[model samples]
Structures are given as structure tokens and as C-alpha cells.
Target: MQQIINFLIRNKTFITYLVLLFIALGLTFNAHSYHNTKFVNSANRITGGVYNTTDAISDYFHLKEYNEQLVKENRELRSKLFNTPASSTERAQLPPGDSLQERFKVYPATVIKNSYSKERNYLLVDRGSRDSVGQDMGVITSQGLVGIIENTSSGYATVQSILNTLSEINASVKNTNNFGSLRWDGNAPDVVQLVDILRAAPIKEGDTIITGGMSSIFPKGVPIGTIRDFTLDISENYYIINVALFNDMTTLDHVYIIENLDREEILNLENTTNEQ
Candidate 1:
């Protein structure tokens, strides 16, 4: 206590001067409108800058949550788009009296692992059987198809990427009955091959390709890729087409997994018919 009293007494003059200076400045600011206005403006600017910096930091931390919300909204929109009736821009025609109620269900997932540079490549996603994903379910992005679900656990699934040599999908040229089998040559990550497209269909360079809806996996009219080039096979009976994929397999992030509600019923009926 004596040391504190000694220090205060020694600095009394300086402390008095500082106190008087602050009082004088306050009186001056209050007495003059211009000084008061300037002080207020400076205070506001400092506070505003602090608020802006804090807001930016908050937004940065919430980016993942915002991204997930966007993914969910996109998934809902796609569900509506795929379950609608056939239109001129979509499918050529629909089966008579076919109601497309709940035809496809979409689930959003993130790619946990990806591979594109091999004869056989696969992807691991953050969805699983618990998310209603199953084997043979089609996986796609907003741009194009990714692959089919090969296996699944409770919390994860593996996709057989379209770049795999063993991957085969049913695809067709848009707005036509011309269909072919989509396959990968494992030569390029961005390109795949479509085989068995008959030459009778009107085909040209840069034509759009889409799912053929031949099977219960992918729905009709889902965009696949564009025709880069095409040539007739040895016998000239069919065209072997080189397709530039819409989805860059090397740069995958989020994907949607599709479940065909009628898949089980169709497979059961076909099996019964074959046994007869």
C-alpha cells in the first residue's frame, strides 16, 4: 500500500495533466457541432469495421452448412424433374396411361474418394445402405452421370466409375430411338465410347447423348455427354462414337444417387417370365 501511494504521488502532476486534457477535449467536442460530428463519425467507422470483420469470419465458418443446404435443394428439384410426364424436350413418348408417381428418388452425397486413372476405377461416397442407397443404383451429378453403386455399408458406398473398363451404361442420342451401350476405353478420363448405335438415325457431330431408359437403373433423358466424333465399325453396320463426358471424372465433389422404385417389381416379373 505504501509503494502504491508513493507511485501515485510521484505521477500526480502527469495524471492531473492527463485528466484535464481529457476534460478539455470532451468540453470542446460537446461545444462545437463539427467536433462532435467528427468524433461520432470516427467512432461509427471503427465499430462498423469491427462488425464487418466479425461477419465475414462467421460466414466463412458456415460455408459447409450452406453448401449442404444447396445440395438438398438441388436434389429435391431433380426429383421433381425426373418424375414428371414425358415432354417434347425430354422423352419422345410415354407408355399409355403410365403415371410416373415416385418413379425416382434422389439422395445427395459427397465424394470421399475418387479414382480415374486406371483400367478399373471406383469412387467411395459418403452415402450408404442406411441412406436408402443400394447396389446398381445410378449416381450422377448436375452435369452428367457418374456411375452405379457397386457396394454399400451403413455409412458409405462404392461407385463403379464410368471410366472403368468394366463399366457399361445404356445411353442414346437425344430426341431419337437410336440407342447404344456406353463403355469406357480407359484411355481418357473425359471421354467414353458408345457402341451399337445403328447408322439409320440422324447423327451429327456435337449431338447430345442421354440415358436410354432401357433398364431400371438410370431414367430416360438424363444428360450424359456430347458426341465428339463417330465412325462406322468394320462391317459399317453400327457406329462407334467417342463421347466427351459432361461430368469431369477427375474433379468430382457432390453427387446424387438415384433409386428406381419399380426396379424390384420389374426384375421379379422378368424372372418369373423367364422361368416359364
Candidate 2:
């Protein structure tokens, strides 16, 4: 305590000057409108900067949650779009007492494994038989089609990717009758080939391609991709088309699985006819 008193006595002159300086500055700020205004502005800017920095940090940490929410919302929208009737004409064509419920069901799944650089690339999703996922269900992302479900276990499923050489899907030109089988050449990851479209079909480099909806898998008009290039076959009767996919195969994350309620009925009827 005596040491403290000695130190305070030694610095008394300097301490008195520092206190007077602060008092004078405060008096000037309070007495002068311009000084007060400048001080308030400076304080506001500092506070605002702090708040902005804090907000940015909070948002960065919440990105994964935001992405999951967006995926869930997209799943709901896809279910509504596929389940709803396509047009007024189709709605009118419904049988007299038919309900307006959608024929296709949609479920969201996350990709647990993916392969793009192989002759037969496959994807594994987090949903399986326990989630009601089964073989032959079509999978897609928000941008475009992905693949079809191949095998399923209790908690996981394998998807036959569109990039696989053995993969074949029924596809067609948007807003036209020209249709073909979509296949991959096992060479390019972003491009696929379409075969069996007639030469006379009106197609161009940028024409849009979509699901033909002839099968029991995908509903009609699900976007596939845009035509990048095409050429007439040696026979000159059909065109071999090169399509640029919309989805980046190397960066797949969330996907939707589509279950066609009428698939079994349709397949059974076709098989019966074949036997006859």
C-alpha cells in the first residue's frame, strides 16, 4: 500500500493532465453540435461494421442447414409437379369419376456414393427398402434426370447412373413427336448419345430434350438436357444425337426418387399380351 501511494504521488501531475484532457474533449463534443454529430457518426459506423461481420459469420455456419432446407423444398415441388395432371385436355380425358391425385410418388434421398469415370457407373443413395425405395424407380435432381434404382437393401440403394454404358432411357425432343433412346458412350461424363430419332425430326444444336414418358418409370416431360450436336447415320434414316447434360455428374448431392404407382399393372398387362 505504501508503494502504491508513492507511485500515485509521483504520477499525480501527469494523471491530472490526462484527466483534464479527457474532460475538455468531452465538453467540446457536448458543447459543439458538429463535434457531437461527428462522434455519433463514428460510433454508429463502428457498431454497424461489428454487426455485419457477426452476421456474415453466422450465415457461413448455417449453410449446410440452408442447403438441406432447399433440398426438402425441391422434393415437395417435384412431387406436386409430377403428380399433377399435365394439361386441361388430359384432365378432361379422365374417366367420369376419376380423382385428381397424382400417379407418381416422390421421395428425397442423399447420395452416399457416386462414380462417374467408369463403364458402368453407379450411385448409392441413403434410402432403401426400409424407405420404400425399390428397383426401377427413377431418380433425378432439380436440374435434370440422374438414373434408375437398380438394387435396394434395408437402408440403402444402388442407382444405375445415366453415364453407364448399359443405361438406356426413352427420351424425346421438347414440344415435338421426335423420340429416341438415350444412351451413354462411356467416354464423356457431361454428354450422352441419343439414337433412333428419325432424320426428318426438327432438331437443332440447342433444342431441349426431355423424357418421352412411354415407359413406366419417368413421367413425361422431365428435362434431360439440351442437344449439343447431331449427325445423320450412314443409312441416313435416323440421327445420332449428342446431348449436354444439365447436371454435373461429378458433383451430385441430393436427389429425388420417383415411384410410379401404375408401373406393376402396366408391366403385368404387357407381359400377358406378350404371352398371348
The per-model lDDT (C-alpha) reads 0.80, 0.82
Query: Tens digits of per-residue lDDT for model 2 on 105-213?
Result: 8999877566899887777777778889998999998879999987675666778889987789999999998889999999999999999999889889999999998
TM-score of 2: 0.68
TM-score versus the correct structure, for each prediction? 0.67, 0.68
Candidates in order: C-alpha RMSD to true structure: 23.0, 23.4
lDDT of 1 by residue, 152-218 (tens): 7666677888898778899999989998999998899999999999978799989999999897899
Error of 2 at 217 (Å): 0.5
Clashing pairs in 2: none
